[model samples]
Target chain A: MSLPTLLEVVNLKKTFVRRSGSFLKPKKTDVYAVNNVSFSIEKGEILGIIGESGCGKTTTVRMIMRLMNESNGKILFNGQNLCGLSDEKTTKVRKDMQMIFQDPYDTLNPGMRIVDILMEPLHAHKPNMTKEEKYQKVKETTEAIELIPAEDFLNRFPHQLSGGQRQRIAIARAVILEPSFIAADEPTSMLDVSVRAGILNLLLDLREKMGLTMLFITHDLSTASYMCDRIAVMYQGSIVEIGETQKIIDFPTHPYTKALVSVVKDLNSFIENRETMILDGEVDSTKKTLGCAFVSRCPHQEAVCHNVVPSLEQIDKVQSVACHCFGSSKMGISERSGALV
Target chain B: MGKTVLSVENLSTFYKTDKGISRAVENVSFTVEEGEILGLIGESGCGKSTVAQSILRLIEYPGKVVKGKVFLHEKELISASEADLYDIRWSEISVIPQSAMNALNPVHRIGEQIMEAILIHEHVSKKEALDRTKVLLELVGIDRERWKSYPHEFSGGMKQRVAIAMALACYPKMIISDESTTGLDVLTQSQVIALLKDLQRKMNLSIILISHDLPMVTSISDKIAIMYAGKLVEWASTDDILHDARHPYSRALLDATPDLINRDKKIVSIPGTVPNLVNIKSCCRFHTRCPFAFERCKVEEPELKEVKPGHFAACFLEEENHELTYTS
Candidate 1:
């Protein structure tokens, strides 16, 4: 039997209306930061949202975390719609949902001690606990994150710890409340190559130990492949493809996903002759296109791609792609429009 | 092999802080031949940037190049006069620093920034410099018409290309790119690296590419230098370092990086953090993290020596020649 869905995002969208021109005649244009994004995470499974900067991967998660209000859609957490929830009810729900930011240096409070920093979450969520009980929980959580000799670390500040250690403390604080769901946003990108593996491993171990569901967001495809069981490829605020990690890496159906996978620099690929699909232009999120978002940079673009947006269609049992080349009657449309371009 | 354009010998740079001296770079040495790209790689705070700044004599107060000699075309740079160094800086050696894309002045046009470098070093008319700036922009694959655009008008990758164009404005023989592509996305980074390689081939220019990214450095560089805690642990050809690395730290670093082609490979992170460098003990700085470290590593410092011809490694395990077991 399949695991029950823990967090589901349906028809989520975020649009930012920009104002320009003179004070007398201000021009307004809508920028679709996130356009009709939908995905669901299975219990105890890790889902990764992979995309470059300004692709709305972070924005989607931010809206889920209630850090930013979504323009439209439904966020169902444990079968409850989070969008219509009261502020007090949302606070209670936030106890089960935690976020780990990218930069450990800035996320942590430099002025506070490690004990106080970790205790902040407990204080908010469990206000009735005694000081001794809170202190004991803090020590246990500190040691749980592998910061051994908890006494030594509990008294220190964030600045005293290394980048890896600081990140561990951040993780400890997030998991202290026993959050069933966590969203890690490029957690290891700011770290060194050697330390990155440790954090990734720790997260993996934590997921197994606590039965936690994770939303791993990253710009690096390799990291996504390593940490995630299922991957979602985002382009211009939309998931162009979603599939199993190995399937996405080996057989990417969408052109944007293919381009992303081709550019990953690996050790073996360095010496071998590999075919690289180099896209022409950067991601233009400002331009509101009526057709497909990737039509401008895609090499296999046809006349149909410029007129109609392709909806996500299942190509295989485990994979789904949003591209005209992989839609219904895929070959027929491509063959007919092949002569025009 | 071409003529040696830059050589650094016994280079040691230190920062004098209130809590003793911090050995930022210790006895690091390497040579760059004409048109050759040497990849200097290490973790953050490992002194890769310090080595670059020392080579360029850009280290300021509190940080001093305590010992060493830097030779640019057989001319000693350590003791060179200020006037001579000024004339040699951009004209002979230029730098594309980390976050160079953001280094572009927001108010000025991209064309004016490229021409400013040329105008300062050489006595040329504004019109002539502008013409050369447009040509340089074209060389870096930017449209000549977009030269007049402000920094905000260009994308991140385009701004980096403009930075490269500015670095090439004076036709420097050697360039130092210190983590210049760190902030760019994977596709844009590959494109920038490809552009750098294309420019290196076309101009026959020597480059010192410094970054912590191993795969990217190995993909483009001819030689690789692996630094750890302000010390050069291994230095060899890209092939030798990739296939036959002797130092435990270098081998462990290779294993630590996540491999894209081989998804099944397990990433092995080193056990400990980089040791403190301030008034450090005379021993292997990587001993805390190196799995093969023995008693000798704690008591005595290993000098970077030639284990094989043209390959240098600072590990005692090279002498023992143990059977190879760890494989990625």
Candidate 2:
């Protein structure tokens, strides 16, 4: 429906070699950060990936960017398999796809001034461009991120800037290449709460102004709901739910989604009266799964849920949920436990 | 509520700088009922930590609680001696700092460190302390065997749970978790919040949760208070504060937050940063940043007055009109 589906990821997988706690040395057991994950983004659409930490969200983005090789799968960017591309081709492809990391403190170079740091990406991508051209591009990008007056901040190092200003430099760097797609990984998590909204608004404004298709990664559902058009809720390495923002927020079908929605303390009196569904324990990233990854914490989880991994099925016009009991009302409100609803 | 466990009245703390003294807290008052969780929501440098540190007299030199009172039950803490404060710091009121890993001693075994606190406060034998420590570890969902492990052996979430367990060891009536789960991942934060709620119910304890995270705090706390530049701008029940916040600062803060459940029509950030708190004048702390700042705000600091049944707001608009016009 949109601009010929610019990027498509078909069944991507990645594994990290983690060391187990023993004298046997670091064994090669896969972390399974991403497994058989498939999704596509239109030319100028912002596709959001929502997940807890260790949920393959980062790995998936890294794989698409070709920062790390996918264990197996096809990533077609502009009808070219990113996995099949030669080192030279990949380098060229990397020019158009860039990532903005979560920690601006760690991402931005402490030694370099703001101008030089933003200029790094341009120097690398467009080596043919003159120094003046690159410097002008850096100025424009800085101005776009509202690091204006960019002239005043051009010579300041990362340490000299505030948390919000440092992040703006990082964003400027990522966008200086004028990448078609961006993977911003929790960009505002490290910034102060007062300054976080400024960065987010910048991203949204830049998306329209610069024609960017961003895959925003964050754990805060509030931010995701506000920023994203279509939300993909990922648990462990799988997309458990995918739908339009309003439907998923108002009438979530998956138990995990419901639990997450229930706990989203509302600013309305109605939320005060609504019961909360408190999920116990942590999201188990270490579990080897043949069935549902959310079964451990899902209150409505049945024997069948433990036996098979449910696929995403259309619940309505705009929402699709991956859960064994999504079709029924049995798992709605009756299955919750002790709470001040 | 079982009983009133912690009562703070007109607590004023000032940070003395080379320039001059900046009043960080002014006549802030709040009470935490037993088995209650009072969430203090604010941006950074809002003087929330100062309030927490003042309760334990943890505020160091150059920073002092100039006036006002703090009471743990009936014990007056404003003028308490250093030795008395030390005795009550952990035994009566303990704090879980922002960084769980940094709060703990890195060199010692975690179990041994916790046992030290138990031994110091309870006057128990080493063996009894060890046993009590194990019980506490199990209570916090950590295996008792983890007692032998070092701090580095555990993950960030595990370290947080251990820190919480150590705080529970002395049976403190009030626990102040200063951004306790801020550094952790969202999943870990939720689990920790659930565990905190469980422990509060079981122990019938009072908690003062200080965090920059507004939405998360609203879900967990019994009531909410918004602080700005060392002043309590608003304080109300979690329901009323979130639903009908009267203070302009509170409204802007709520607008600033990215709603997890429902996104706002437009992303509206609170314009500008908090004023630098050094040699400040008699004007309202939020006047520099407030969208509705008028002549009255710049000249006179608005007093926090009762707006609704339990809602308290500090703004000249509310003071003059007796109601607030908050645009969603």
Candidate 3:
């Protein structure tokens, strides 16, 4: 049976006003950092938001966490509109939802010991708890993350620990309160491959142990495919594609998604498909567009693609795409899907 | 493989920190052939960058290459004077630093930077240098019209292209690309990798592509060298290393990377953190986390031995028949 949706984001939008062109002739333009982005996460499901830099993946998560105000749309968590809640109410709601940042070194405080760092949440949430009770809870959480002999690391500072250990501590802090929903923004991007593997596996373990509904944000398709149950491809502040992980990688429909899949650095495909495909130009999120944002770099762009904006539409039961030319031309959905076979 | 363009032997570099001496690169030895790409794959703090820096003789204060020899094609570079090294820096061996994407001077024009680099190594006139800069830009598939633009004016991909262009200005025999595509998006990374491969073939230039992204490195490198805890644990042809890895660390690293095609394969993490570099023990560095580590692994270090015809692995598990006892 399909799980009930725990978090649903509807028509989310965020815009930053750019006041530039010198102080003499100041120009104000609205840059749509996130435009009408929407997705849902089921309880105990891992939904990965994959994209390049400045694609509004971070901004979307920030809005969902209510760390920053969204310019428009709804953030519904367990059927409650989080955007409409008061500061105190939102703060209470935030306890069940935690965030893991990209860089562990930067996110953690340098001066605090490991115990103090992990205890801040407990102290804030349970102000009247006994010292013995807090210590037992902290010890259990540390052991859960496999930080062996919790007593050894409890007194040490963040700097005393390695990059991998620091990240584990960060995860420990996040799950200390036993949050139901977790948003990890490139949690392992800054770590080494071996260390990254540990962190990724830790996240997976924590999800199973805590029954977490996770939103994983990353630019890496390979990692996303490995970890995520459903993958959402974001581009220029919009989700160009979203589907089952395997289906998306095997038969990508959107031009951007197809290009992303092709460039994944698969060692086996290197010789045969050395020069297979490459999307031209960089992502420009500054432009105010009435049409598709990927038109400038897309190889399958038609005349109509430049003038008409394509909303995400379902192509099948398991897949959806936001492209007008997806099933329209010879380079359409059928032809592209044929490539997979 | 072509003629060995660069050979490093017993290269040991150390950093004198307040706590103790940290051996960042220890007795590392490897060879890079002309017109070949040698991939250096390692985790962070594994001395991958240290090895690269020691070769270029770029280690700063509190860090020194205590012992070793670096030969650029047959000439010894370690004993060479700083003045002589300057001549070989850009002309003989150039470097496209890891952070080169944003390494461009924000104040100066892109064309001027490339031109200045050319003029520094070669006694070319201002006009000739400028003309050569345009050609270099074009060679890297960058628009020559944007030569007058500043670094910030260009995109991340464009900045990377300009960096590659600058690296090519001197037509060095060898180029050291240290984590060139680390922060780039996948699409841009592929483009850059393709550009580097194309340039390597066209110019017959040797490259040492150092990166933590193993698959990306394996895609272009003719040979791969795996480093762990400031030591070379494995070295073999890209295909051999990828398919028939012998070192436990290498196997763990391969397993750690999530497979794209094989969905059922679970990612097995190497337990424990990297050993502290300060006053490192004599035993195998990876033994602490290696699943198959035996009693011998705890007491003695294993040297890199040729387990197969072309593949070498530093491990005690490999028998004479090339059978590994460690099961994944």
Best by DockQ: 3
User: Each model's TM-score, in the order given?
Assistant: 0.94, 0.86, 0.95
Query: What does candidate 1's lDDT look like per residue over A1-341, in tens digits?
Result: 19999999999999999998899999998899999999999999999999889999999999999988999999999999999778999999999999999999999999999999999999999999999999999999989888899999999999999999999999998999999999999999889989899999999999999999999999988888889999999989999999999878777778777767756734233222222344558677888888999987776778889999899988878889898876445434453232211
Q: Can you list each candidate's DockQ?
A: 0.55, 0.44, 0.62
Alpha-carbon shift of residue A51 in model 1 (angstroms):
0.8
Top candidate when judged by TM-score against the true structure: 3
Whole-model lDDT per candidate: 0.88, 0.81, 0.87
Superposition error at A211 for model 3 (Å): 1.9
Candidate 1 vs 3: which has more DockQ: 3
Please give the TM-score for the first chain of candidate 2.
0.90
Give the lowest summed-lDDT range of ten residues in model 2 chain A: A267-276
Residue B111 local lDDT, model 2: 96
Each candidate's number of clashing pairs is: 0, 5, 0
Which is superior by TM-score, 1 or 2?
Answer: 1
In the range B138-243, model 2's lDDT, one tens digit per residue, is 9988989889899988888889999999888888888999999987876567667777888888888889999988877887799998899988999999888878
Assess the local accuracy of residue A102 in candidate 3 as a C-alpha lDDT between 0 and 100: 90
Lowest-lDDT window of 10 residues in candidate 1 chain A?
Answer: A267-276
Q: What does the lDDT read for residue B235 in candidate 2?
A: 92
Can you rank all candidates by lDDT, best first?
1, 3, 2
